[model samples]
Target: MAGRQRWMTVVCVVGVGMLTTAGCDGTAEPAAAPTSAATRSVTPPVPRDLFSPRPEVVRTPQEACGGTPFRAGAVRAYTPDGPRYDGPGPHPVKLLRMESDLLGMGPELPYQWTGPRPAQLVVCEYEDETFDSRQVGTCEYLGGTVLGATARVQSARFVYRVFEARTGTLVRQFTLRGNTTPEETCPETTYAKTALYDQQVESKDLVAKIRPLVERDR
Candidate 1:
């Protein structure tokens, strides 16, 4: 959101929940080996929770959309607002609209749309439930050593929308929250180029909760 911060990982964008990591570049000097008790006692800086809290009350899609779903006849018109992809294969699904702050991350990965292109093109809209970006930089050696850190946490709304392409009819709307921050990365500790995999294991629990929905889609 903030004018592209330092070192963002370039990801392959295929479909919702089908993200995979690509290569990265940057640099960091190796963290000086701890030589003293004070150094050993000092713990590395961790980012604060990136996600903001959401309302406690959850609403069903029927309740949210007034028992009917929202529909769009064409997404290409909105391509100027976001990226739009024409039907990858032959099904009448005219177009797809993707809106995200991470759009600048990288190019879309190559993928084949497998399945009968539905007689009615279904537009699936993914709303991010939790999108948190945070960073911290510090001088490690009693305010002498300089080190920088960053992390991100993302979660998607369970209730995604499916709409008919031509008629703009809403159909097959479902709520299944899944894939909460299933993947993550952090700045290399010693040298910024390290590309350390600093994923918080705690986030895996969120992924587990969403796996069933992902599997169902597959």
Candidate 2:
């Protein structure tokens, strides 16, 4: 929303819910301590009530978020207004994400992706409900602290998208901003570089929120 503001953990593109909700997992943590730098982590996103753009909505899928070359239920043409700012018919979806240190606070850990990116736009979908309620925006060394304070800044960007499932179009998009300046450079917080793990988690969580909506509507 606003430009980078101090230290950031996760900033999903959506302003708020449907916009959704969030969490993260415990992996190999680093041995350093966190420096006392003011930082903010973004929250999850989900639609109001439980769903937006009900399932009955229809259209093609976003190629940016879509995994394959040909997205499902999406369209190539824009709206009559001429710009396609709004996503397609709308299957229903909200922005989702988990914040983590990209600086490597511990042993380097890699992540796996269940979906593809740079996708057409409609491909932006998440389905990880098992671990949705976690609030792990930033990763700090298990036992580390910043002493005396220092002048250091290291930031990384996170990428994601919001898709309208019915038409498979991307309604919104987000690129997160974050950084870390451990008092002790040697010991800092690190997060998944690949970030796919977090993405998968986000997708599943969104699905969880949509479940009730899908059922009631069905």
Candidate 3:
């Protein structure tokens, strides 16, 4: 009888030990992993100047020749180190707009390219391109190529150059001087905001008016 009682105690002790072990195991919790350093470090985007790969010019080459009227000046041809003037110069075409009718272009703004991408594909492409700052900023020091324009006293500068990405041929261009600076840097923004009512429209207006002076026999 004592032997049987001792066996029962041994069994109960074993069961109690097992139950205690299981309860301890159930109460234990797992530890979490550590987070990365980036979770603590964050930064913001600020505007600054940088080099651009586009061609720039101060004067148009096909200027109002009573010549090509658009005057793809040294800047247009993509070589000029300085501006172009009318009269006997290396580039014959001079004077972008000679008519007195286009002085008020800032009223009706003409749509132009901006940069950095804002909302969707098309609208985001032209976010920062407007040059309303009236300050001189650009990729002026890049060594690839350069174009510039000059008048009797004043010369113009374009911060961005528009070229056929497919063929590399020069197309349209925008300046960082006026209120028409380019916004985003994406190449796909070429088709967005096809036109605006500012100086761009004024330039086109002058071109349309002088079409007869330079539009050749083609």
Go through the candidates in order and give the C-alpha RMSD of each one to the true structure.
Answer: 31.0, 31.0, 24.7
Lowest lDDT sum, 10 consecutive residues, model 2, at: 106-115
- lDDT digits (tens) for residues 1-218 of candidate 2: 23757774642322322322232234432333333455544566755657444343222333224433334353332111122323332222322222223332311111121122211223233222332233224323343354232222233344445443333354454443322223333333333221212311233443443333322322
Question: How many residue pairs clash in all the candidates, one count each?
Answer: 11, 55, 42
- Per TM-score, the best of the predicted structures is 1
Candidate 1, after superposition: displacement of residue 93 in Å?
4.4
Q: lDDT for each of the candidates?
A: 0.33, 0.32, 0.26
Write the residue-wise lDDT of candidate 1 on 16-62 in tens digits: 44554532233332333334675455755655545564433322323
Preferred candidate (lDDT higher): 2 or 3: 2
By TM-score, rank the candidates, best first: 1, 2, 3
Model 3 residue runs over 4 Å out of place are 1-69, 77-102, 105-169, 172-218
Q: What lDDT, from 0 to 1, does candidate 1 have? A: 0.33
